[model samples]
Target: MTQPYEVFVQWKRGGAHEHAVTVTASDREMALTLAKRNVDVRGAPVSIWVTPRSEIAQTSADDPTLAPSIEREYRNVSWYARERQ
Candidate 1:
């Protein structure tokens, strides 16, 4: 079976880029072809990137290692919640 890969695309300048698609392909060339085809179907994408799925280091589904140990009041946007009371 072909290796798993992930694709990302930039739809427009200054727009926050996002994941576009995921596909299995033999190599980068094949992945690019798939990405281009998707771009055509989804309209023009400003930029594209394809990386092997294994290359992406990510947090585990059940891992909270990145969570802050202490609660931060400044980080709370819900401060308005108290005002509404």
Candidate 2:
């Protein structure tokens, strides 16, 4: 059965990989080949990575429980203003 794969590409040596696209394939090898042909058409990628979509875990940004309950002004830069003489 085919599986969904997330494609990531590094445009330069030693650069962080960025999400390029998604491809469906029966296995990892075919996923890589398909991603290369489809997403890297310009030959800009220095490296490529294909990961199974099922393997990734993510949290929702809108989750209210993830936010801090108390005020924390120290975390913001505006809290550190200089005092006028």
Candidate 3:
């Protein structure tokens, strides 16, 4: 039976792998093959990743533990651009 696989590609070295597309295949090898054919058709990515969709982990959107560790009011661009008192 075919299963869904997630495809990721890194366009350049030291870059992050970005989600490319999903492919359905019978096994890992076929998934990789299809990912290459579809994702690497251009200049070729620095790397390609094919992972079974079921194996990837996801976090709850509202998880409190995942919140930022500290307030960062100064990091906002408006904070610097606002009218100075």
Candidate 4:
């Protein structure tokens, strides 16, 4: 049976990997080929990663634990404005 795979591409060396596309394949080799053909037509990517979708873990934005319990006022733009005054 074919499985869904998430494709990630790195545009250049030392660059962050970005989600390029998703492909369904029986194995990693096929997924890589499909991902390269479908997403890297211009050959711009320096690296590619194919991970099974089922293996990925995701968290919801609505989750209360997603943010820190303590205040982080220094990270806010208002904090900078207040400091300038």
Give all candidates' CA lDDT scores: 0.84, 0.89, 0.88, 0.92
C-alpha displacement of 62 in model 3, angstroms? 1.8
State the local distance difference test value for candidate 1.
Answer: 0.84
Please estimate how well model 3 matches the true structure, expressed as its whole-model Cα lDDT. Answer: 0.88
Considering TM-score, which of the candidate structures 3 and 4 is the better prediction for this target?
4
lDDT by residue for model 1 over 1-85, one digit each (tens)?
5897799888889887688789889998899888788666888888888999999999888786777779776577787677678
Q: Which pairs clash inside model 2?
A: none
Error of 1 at 55 (Å): 0.3
Q: Which stretches of candidate 3 lie over 4 Å from their true place?
A: 41-43, 68-85
Give the TM-score of each candidate.
0.75, 0.76, 0.69, 0.77
**Per-residue lDDT over 1-85 for candidate 2, one digit per residue giving the tens place of the 0 to 100 score:** 9999999999889999999999999999999999998876767788899999999998888887777889977676776663222
lDDT of 2: 0.89
Q: Candidate 1, clashing residue pairs? A: none
RMSD of each: 3.5, 3.5, 4.5, 3.2
TM-score of 4: 0.77
Model 1 stretches astray by more than 4 angstroms: 75-85
- Please give the distance, in angstroms, between residue 84's alpha carbon in candidate 2 and its true position after superposition: 15
RMSD to native, candidate 1: 3.5
